[model samples]
Target chain A: MMKSWDPRIEEMPKEDLQRMQYRLLKSLVYRLYSFSPFYHDRMREQNVHPDDIRELTDVKKLPFMFKRDLRDNYPDKIFTSTKDELVRYHVSSGTTGKPTVVGYTQNDLNTWTTSLARALTSVGLGRGDVIQVSYGYGLFTGGLGMHYGAERIGATVLPTSVGNTERQIELMQDLGATAIACTPSYLLHIGEVAEKMGVDIKKDTELRTGILGAEPWTDRMRTRIEDWLGIKAYDIYGTSELSGPMFTECVEQKGFHVWSDIALVEIIDPKTGESLESGQKGELTITILQKEALPMIRYRIGDITTMDDEVCACGRTHPRIQRIQGRVDDMLIIRGINVFPSQIEYALMAIPEVGQHFQIVVERKGALDDMLVRVELTKESFSDKINDIIQVRQKVEHRLRNSLNVNVTVELVEPGSLPRFEGKSKRVVDKRSL
Target chain B: MDTQKFVIRQISIFSENRPGRLAAIAHALGEENINILAFSIAEANGFGVVRALVDYPEKAHDKLFSLGYNVAFTDVIAVRMKDQPGGLYEVAKVLGDAGVNIEYSYAYSGKEGAVLILRVDQVDEAIKKIKNSGATLLERSVFH
Candidate 1:
């Protein structure tokens, strides 16, 4: 009756989840009609009143809001709280389009940071630990995000907003930074710079833990980062959309805890529009159970993943979800074949010769969609063997066909040829010229 | 569209994602005395073509392959011109006028002159006007 990921939330029992869910849901339902014009009109159109739901069984009566709705409403539109109380602003990546902005008030900031602190606690970062934040300090969530949590934990905070490679390493070493929060890629870059400066990152002083997120990374990447820095790397899963760093892997490293205190999590069929049972992968949706400035209900987060009530090996009583595979927006359909670019990234990263610099070009030829993958050599001063390029390309094609089961043309490029990114990198190009 | 034919000897080399692929190619070029005057790499889908203008490109091809790389040579035209801004636009316009679609292109120039490695829509005619215009279509060089 007890599963690995269930004990944390499972022992609470259905009655408890429902009790807390509806209590907040009742408040959220009221607020939807009270403050949010979209929800107010929506609930009216659905003709559903809060009292109509006798139990959590009627949670479905509440409407769902997708990312597109957020994009259309954007900033200042869907805000439930007035401008006076709004104190913090977080942004979603414009990867799919213009980034949507979300605002929070002082109380919301406290709740958000408290939630982040819970995530931080999962990995054992607390008071006195000097945490270096390398995520970009902008409208983006990474920087100020882990910052608030580090403060919440009373850890000495270093808001090292992303890269200035020389300065980052200098401060990292000089400050004896005990914990670092940044994208998994940037951390690797920092390690590279540290090695070149004759500072063995592995032998370096005091950095004991890393909170890496902002981009989806594989377990291989986890090992890669941890091995390079000689530190325990914990995965932090969140976005500006969800108030930042809601779920994080505990020291037990089983997976990420759902941080259910602030947000309610559910998995549902992206197509069927029905919530899926545990252990099934689907579109993730959440209700902002605790928020003042902007509370979203059944907000459809385009991230695709699974959830479970199974107890975690980590002692936490909250349930855990697997690391997100990738965003639904990142999906590519070439020749009517579904492909996730992360799959290609995985295949190419597995290849020693293929550098992280990769580009996918999708063009339509006649009635067929042709997708090409261009992987560059790691650096200049390096030449590719024609045989190796062909072999590697062939291997990549094989992997792509076998894994995503899509046909793709693979090209091997010279080093420094692919476009680079200072922030979240773009991976696919729809070169259909439409 | 039948133009003067100039062999560029494009070599397709396979390298992994790591530091030092260019160095290996440069080393081979230096050993063979193949002068890479004008070279460009068209990169996408992880593979790129290393097109170069050398003194004896045929010999460069042999040297690259012998160095344990799978190298292939394709004929291309290297058009020389006065080093200036519109020189490229002129070339492209001329090629475009002749209905030559550019499959790929890379350019390199120095104080003496500029050379454009162009894979044109119409290779033969474009080369004739280019050669007639006094542009020396340099051979793949051992002096690269």
Candidate 2:
């Protein structure tokens, strides 16, 4: 691992990275002018021509294009290259009316694979390993990105898609997978299934490592997963547009290793438009530099992250990022307090008897948002004394007040009552009557 | 630091599996206005033993016996511990090699030091061994 593809590129001393970034920005200004109608019209209105932009410092001159603009443009208006050059296409397909379609050029695909490969390797998965890609296959980047990375690493790949928990167990046991990849929440579901079928996940399965991502989780969830699954769970950081997981958890598991070799991540204050210093939390904006075909420059992704220039315990010199707290879109601003549903979910995870199946109900009450968390009791919990269950509920509600600093009502429902997702789990139900 | 102050009492409590066990323990001492300097619990296969070293050693002994639940006042020291991993290791390793077994122990966070409630096989001998090992023993001043 001495001096990755370009040590100076990965380590490109902040000042040097700035110099190279400006050089790349100049090219972005030219490309945006040529291909994107959205950017071409904006640059003209701002009187900011490609020629006026000299270096990376001139990034401020480029007007930001948001996810909305991409959605409004739909299939091809936001695309820079021709449909023929677009080797791959993925859509957001979120519950929000319109799904943003993003296309990738052939070279863009290569950069994505390299980034995904780096993430897989960060978790110690390489040649002679068996990786079961359990993330869904089409219209989503998680499955394919993991598929190709396992392929690139020359490891055996098992495309298990999403559910069929019983079959997943059958394959995991029969195939003897060394590493499993999927959402952390779904992994817990599988853990429950194994317990029901009387399979000791620790002894029955040869699973030594797992790469769980595509959803945000807490450190408490990490401990629960490790103890339950009997494997070290590494968080894989990715998005459909930014070419899949750019960061992967190293052995230290403190923070994620940013694939800075190909991508440049900058944490900037949304209001001031200034780069927040290392270790401060803010909105994250990314620039896809050096992708021969589809190059993105200073694109704001709206992800909130804890960024620091501190060197990690893993010995990599690249800047590391804390696991994403929540998307700016996912945040619920209740009476001016920023509350991510993941934070609520994390509070629920701390109640071990409560397990992972839970939902957050956000409602407007007297000009303020009132929170209610409804969690399902595990079979193991039901078999225990009834009085302990009520105490757990009280503890969960009390902890939510301390952890979230907001009042919450915790309700314990019977098992199998809450909805489980075959796709993405919709845990947050916002019922604000504005 | 030994005979001049403090009393170690083994307080037995019958706690039904319910909320406010810790709160009840806090309230029981609150009624008598006696302060607990250090405490620990060792749960049997069924019941739990709550041992406490309280301030107003004589009053705490009278208060627990009056409440009634097989409470015994014994000779136990309030040993000091560092809030670190090897901190426990050093004490445990020394007593282990000395053939002195720590039967059960309890702990609570303190402002200056983490207070330990240890029930060892040899109380008087373990106290001397712990003091010689350079560990500080807390006094009634903590409860007061």
Candidate 3:
């Protein structure tokens, strides 16, 4: 039977959801105006008041908060609640620059755990199941966020964290873990380790489902993982600001259902900031409706996706989002053609000869830009024959050009030569000064 | 194929075709007191494959791998040819006539004769063809 954590919230009518969002939006704006100075000044500068947002569309009138706001404000400027009221805090990698900080009050923590619990339950994980979390713990929300959710469902939680593939496999088999949560890439890495140890995960382990997210993965990769580990893979979605892994795919695996009660979402043309119609690919903007510590209005998440309001086969009324294509910052413009690293990943994964490790390097050649895709061959396919290797390289290049509509040089490297990451693989290297 | 004949192991080092790469690799092997008897660099695109017949194949391989160079061993039959002209022509004619394809070949003149290293499609068949043509097959101990 199809299961939902909160049937009332998930199956609410469209009109009621919109009306609830409008009411919540109004109160959230006033609360931000009263508590947070950054929001107050921004709202005053834009000449938008709490009364201005009588309806939901007025959310546009409020200033859109760029990720830069978090950087500029630094530690506590964005926090609506004081330090004494805070229960916990999480920080992003800040790899690009200063790390974005988020805080949660006791109530906010409850909401986060409950939201993730709903997500886990929606994917068919519950009481009798032992959910193993493979995401990195500590400062990263991926591990603890999923950890609390599984506990909330009365399931035995295995806080294995990440790394130690042999131990992870041992625990998965000996403990009979029925469900596991981690990035799809990491899951595949574990499968590879299992194979090397001669432990057939499909036959040896009791894992039946996987909750995969944190990095964008293709359906082709999903099929490979399913065939390798014999598990049903579900995509869960969230950002640190909105709470980790709140939206998730139900058993249908059609799209990720966003809880309207917790957040409001909008798709807009990233270049112009104008709202786009549903089903049109664009930038995804979100507003945290239930957040207490740091409430953001129209926060641009930078993810690119389309929304579908059609009711899912699982009967959830919450609008679903197509799997993220790529982050806006990850798009590459090569010789007047726009390409996404995920698109290249999808194309590369489609080819059976290509291994999962790949990198796209964009370089300026004189006046024109050139893209070089470095991909590794599988161990079985790595050949000593130069002509055979060259043929495989040319085939990869041809497939990439067919998908990206631009000429790309594909270099076939030896197996295990390219760098691999434990979390969030870096696949693109831009060397052009322009 | 003679069971008594020893097959010489050729160490092929994968490297980028840039200046000083070969010298650095040679320096590493020389530092280990391993002598490189015969060596050839095959260039393709921007990369090169440096194949060397070292006195101690196993020690050379370990040193190269420890230096983080992509290295592998390939078996190639080494036959003694005349040091004068028509030496390569004779070896090539015999292999071609026997329907054996020589993928690549390299040679070095020594005190005994010119040592021709041939990597063919069929190693055993090429060994028979070279033996039938009256060419002296060198043993792995010849390099050692």
Candidate 4:
């Protein structure tokens, strides 16, 4: 059966979608230039003015915003609203240096909540489903973002947050929870813990659907989670700056449909900053159409993916992305070969002997670059026999070499030897000094 | 005879091959009042394995483990030999002729002459060979 949370916008005609975008983009540009000095200076430097944007094509005249710009303006310089206007805000823990802060007015919060609710409904989650939001809460937008969306959908929401896997399973079983929202990695972790406790989630619990996002995961990982928890796994995509988890995969599991009425999405060539044709892979750029407290104009999101404008099987007209490939910063180029850690993760996860805990170490040896994948063997796969262990390591090495098209050295370590992360995990350690 | 009483449990700790790792292990065990009677360190690649005979093998294993060191116990035979030249060769030759491969071996001297610790592929067969050769095998009680 097909369903939609907002049929009017979801089924809007192609011309109407473009007309709506043009109307929002023209005003958004003029408003930002008038209110936010950051945008005004950037537009001025680019020799663009509010009068320049007359048609949708004129959006190309506006300046692009990057993470560096956000860092340079830190705190509240980028905000269009004053202190009295912002009802709530979230700050990203920069980890490197200065943090990027985003503010939200009451109307902006309502839009964010509705956008998320629409995303959730597209994936067949609504009232009567007990959803357990397991994404971490607080400064990170993932937890509360999904929490309010589930509540807005009228679905019973259990704000379980993250961690305490054993008790999480108990609550799910006892409460008959039908859905869960968390990082795909954490969902898999809960499944592992459930298995240890002799609880077969697939057969014993009522979990039927999982809303997973915040980290790039492979289709293979989705299948693994679905098999483990007996749930339909859907990919949700968003950034803290633009509002968390605004796009999600429909029941078809084809791609995540971006809510074009609220946010404008474009795929651009990362190096050239030129927009690419539909079905062509490039860096994803987003612009908030209705955001008031902090509007983003042509914001380069750093994610790489292709956009499909074709009408979906579920009857939604909003353009969908063909899965997030990888972040531009997360891509590694070794000796003319481009490889993504997520690809390596997919290859490793497909092998039953290899556990999820693995790290890629890139070092320079003489003039050549070397990539060493150090992964841990599952406890059951860890054997005392030297020949058996060697064969396992060789199998992993051969699999990686075949998949990546690059010869990589695979080192097998003991279980629990590699580092584990609660949030977005760091899988690469580059020592090339290049 | 209970093999637990006769067999000497040698604690082997996996450590990175760097300075102060051995000293750290020594200090940790010493703090627990667990004396390391005889110890040998074998290193390969960038990691070293510290195999030691302590007064209480279980106690030392727990102490080393709780102190954040990867430690395990292996049952090794401690055979007493005359503290003279070729004392090791005599014991090695017997185990070699018995077709038992010696993975690793360490030696230490005490008031009761020299004792050689042997970690072989076949512990039972090597024990039989030592018994037949009249080489005195030091039981766990002798360490006490």
Candidate 5:
């Protein structure tokens, strides 16, 4: 039988869900127009009033919010709720610019936790299951978000925040953790540490499910993790701006189900700033209809993915967004071709001789763009014959050229030479910018 | 005579071509008191394969590998040549005429005689051709 934390909302009819979204969006617009000066001035500048947002599609009338808006507001200038109403604050570490602070009222926290509860339940995790939260805690939403959701689902929570992999593996064994939530890279790191410790995760540990997100990963990586560690890896999607890791893929693992009651998602053509129909790939824009402290209306999240309105096989009625292809800013234009690091990873993972670590270096030589992919050769693939190594490099170059539609120079580096990060790994080095 | 006894193990290390990389490798081998008999560096794009004949090939490989170097053992034939002009020509002509392709070759002259280490495409065929051509070949025990 199917299990859901909130069956009423998760299984609501399509028409009813849209109607509820429209109602919540209307009140949210009206509240912001009346109370928040930032939203009011932006709306007035765009000549959009609360009355303009009558139908659900009328959301197009409002101006799109941006990460810049949050940065410009800095600490909490854009928040609609008052300081006394906020129960907690989670600030995103703005690596590019000023950090954006998110304030959460008690109800806002409940809504965030409830969204995760439904998501966790949809993935078939509850009670008796031990979920190890491996995402970093504190200001980052990944840890606390999964932590609260796992706890709410009646599961035993093991708050093992990132790092100390050996110990995390020890706890995973000693505590008999059944599931873990963390970045895919971190999970891979744990697997390596476990193997080095002579602890076979598949045979010894009870871990079976992984909620991996917070960075872009490929389906090939999913297969590798599943086959290697003997775990079902599910992709979780959310940003700190949207209440921090809210929705995740159910056991079917098709895509992440974005709950309609909490937030409304839209795929928009990033260049023209126009909404696209379902199943068309574009930038992910969202409207947090029920967020009180910081309500985001048509916020451009900048992630590129397609949305599927068709209900999932899991029997949930919420729409599912496909796995994030790549971020808008992360997309690289090499020799007039759109290339993504994830695509390179996908292609590299397919080749048996290629290792997991690779770095892309892009530079402008004269008038042309030159891309060089530095791939680490796995120990298993290393050969004594120089001709064999040359063949591997040529094969890698050929595969990358076919996948990316751009000529690439492949350099076979020694294993463990490339940089490895505990969190998100920065694989691209664009020397052209410098 | 069994030519297999003449096949010697050559250690090849993959390294990025940069300053002090060779010195670092040499220092590590020196720390272990391993003598490099004959070595050749092959260069490609920004990387090099350091192929060497050492007295203690197994020990050198382990030390270098334990130090995180990508090391592999390749079977190469070390042929004894006359320590005079055309000494290489005699061996090169014999292999070329026998339809054996030498991938790479390095030579070192000691007080005894000049020895040519040939990395050939076909190890067994090269050993048989060299031995059949009346060319004296050094046994693996000579290097050890």
Candidate 6:
């Protein structure tokens, strides 16, 4: 039978949930307008006021908050709450710009933990379940966020925050860990390390559920992990800005259930800032209604996905968002065609000869964009014959061309030479910018 | 008529076409005291397959594999042909007439004679046809 951490709020009627969301959204707007100078000025510039927000959909009038806003504010300049009320701080190390800081009050932490508690419970995890968190612990929110959520659901937290894979596998077996929360790439690395250590995770370990997120992964990858590791790998969604990893797909594995009372999610045309109807693909915009230290109203998350309001089979009335397609910032234009690294990963996963590690190098030659995919040859698929290796490369190139609608140069590297990550894996190296 | 005795194991290593790669592979093999009797490098699309008839095929494979090289063993037959003209045609004609397809062939001239290493689609058929054609086929002992 399906279990819920807070069924009163989780299984609430659709109309009641909407009513609650509207009230929370209205109160959050009024509070932000009264206290936050940043939001106050942004609302004035956008010609929006708290009184104008009569219905929830009127949130479209609020100016969209962006990563740059956080970067511009730097170290809590935009935080509405004072330093005394803030109990925790999580900073995302930006690759290019100044790191964005997110402060949370004690109440904010509870809301975040409660959100994950319901999420973890929806995925059928509860007491007697040992969750080994493999995400990076310090600064990064994945480890602590999952740690609190797993603990709140009455599950024993393993606290194995990334690296030491062989040791982690040993502890996983010794402690009899039942679930693990980590990035998908890190989990793949763990599986590889376990195989090298001669430990068969499927037969030897008690790990049955994987709450994998923090990097965009594909459905095909989910199938591969499930079939290979004998675990139901569920996609968890959130960023450091959203109080770490928040929601996850339940046992049904269709989409991630976004608890409506905590946050409001909208799909918007990223180019025009116009909201798209449900089921239409667009950028994911979210408004955190209950946050105190950092309340995000219409924060543009820069991820592309569609929304579904249909009730989940798991009996949750909250709306569900499909698996993240790709980040808008991660999208690359090759020869004037938009390409996502996740799309390349999805295409490569279908081929048997290609291993899990691959790097996409995009360079500008003369006038045209040249894309080269350096893929590792799996140990199982290595061939001694030159013709066989040639055929494999040709097959990979053909498959990529067919799927991406662009010609790609494929270079086969030795297995285990590609970089493996304990955190988010940087797969794309666009030399065009250089 | 015993063609099984003529089959020799050749170690093949996958290598990228980069500077010092061949040297690294040779150094690893030499550290294990393995001798490369006859070898051929096949190039395709920025990569090469270094196929060599080593004295200890299994040992060389294990050594290279331990050094993180992708190595495998293939069964190839060595046919002793005339060092002069038409020696390759003599063995080639026999295999072609017998419907044995030669996937690849590399020859080396030594004190013994010009021995043509043949990787055929039909290994047993090619061995039997070459043996029946009155040509001298080198046994595994000759290479080992």
Which candidate gets the maximum TM-score versus the true structure?
4
Q: Give a tens-digit lDDT track for model 1, residues B55-84.
A: 676788788766655456556777776687
> What would the per-residue lDDT of candidate 5 be over residues A287-344, giving only the tens digit for each residue?
9989999999999988899999998887889999999886777666564234668778
Q: Candidate 1 chain A: minimum summed lDDT over ten consecutive residues — where?
A: A1-10
Q: State how far residue A63 of model 2 sits from its true place (Å).
A: 1.9
Cα displacement (Å) at residue A238, model 6:
0.6
Q: Give me candidate 3's TM-score against the actual structure.
A: 0.61
> Which one wins by TM-score: 1 or 3?
3
Residues B13-71 of candidate 4: C-alpha lDDT, one tens digit per residue: 76656788789889988888888889898765444568889998888888876765556
* lDDT, model 2, position A290: 58
Between the candidate structures 3 and 4, which one is better when assessed by TM-score? 4
* Candidate 3: tens digits of C-alpha lDDT, residues A1-434: 23877788888888999999999988999988887888999999999888899898888888898877886778768788889999898876332324568898988878888888778888888888999999878767888899988899888999999879899999999999999998776787788888889999899989999998876767887898898799999998887778667878888898898888888889999999998888999999998899998887889988899999788888888888989887777756564334667677778778888787788888866434679998876535444456655677789999888777668998765456678888777788988652
lDDT of 2 at A185: 58
DockQ of 1: 0.13
lDDT of each: 0.70, 0.69, 0.82, 0.81, 0.87, 0.87
Q: What TM-score do all the candidates reach, one by one?
A: 0.59, 0.56, 0.61, 0.63, 0.61, 0.60
| Per-residue lDDT of model 1, residues A1-434, tens digit only | 11222234434654566587778778778767877778888888888887876776577788887766776777668887888888878765332324568898998888777777777766777777899998777766667878888888778998888658779888888998999988776677778778789888767768989987766667887887788789999888875667766678878776787756567788888887799898999988888788877677788877788887675665565667777775656765443233556667766666675586789998766424578888765433233233444666677677666555457787766556679888777978876532
What i-RMS does each candidate reach, in Å? 7.7, 14.4, 3.5, 5.0, 1.6, 1.2
Write the candidate numbers in order of decreasing DockQ.
6, 5, 1, 3, 4, 2
True-contact fraction per candidate equals: 0.24, 0.00, 0.00, 0.00, 0.31, 0.45
Task: Give the per-residue lDDT of model 4 (tens digit) for A125-171.
Answer: 88899999998788778888889999998999999988788999999
Off by over 4 Å in 3: A331-427, A430-434, B1-144
Q: Give the per-residue lDDT digits (tens) of candidate 6, residues A139-182.
A: 77888999999999889999999778899999999999999998
Q: How many pairs collide in each candidate, listed in order? A: 70, 3, 0, 0, 0, 0
Model 5 chain A worst lDDT window (10 residues): A91-100
- Which portions of model 1 show Cα errors greater than 4 Å? A1-18, A95-97, A331-434, B1-144
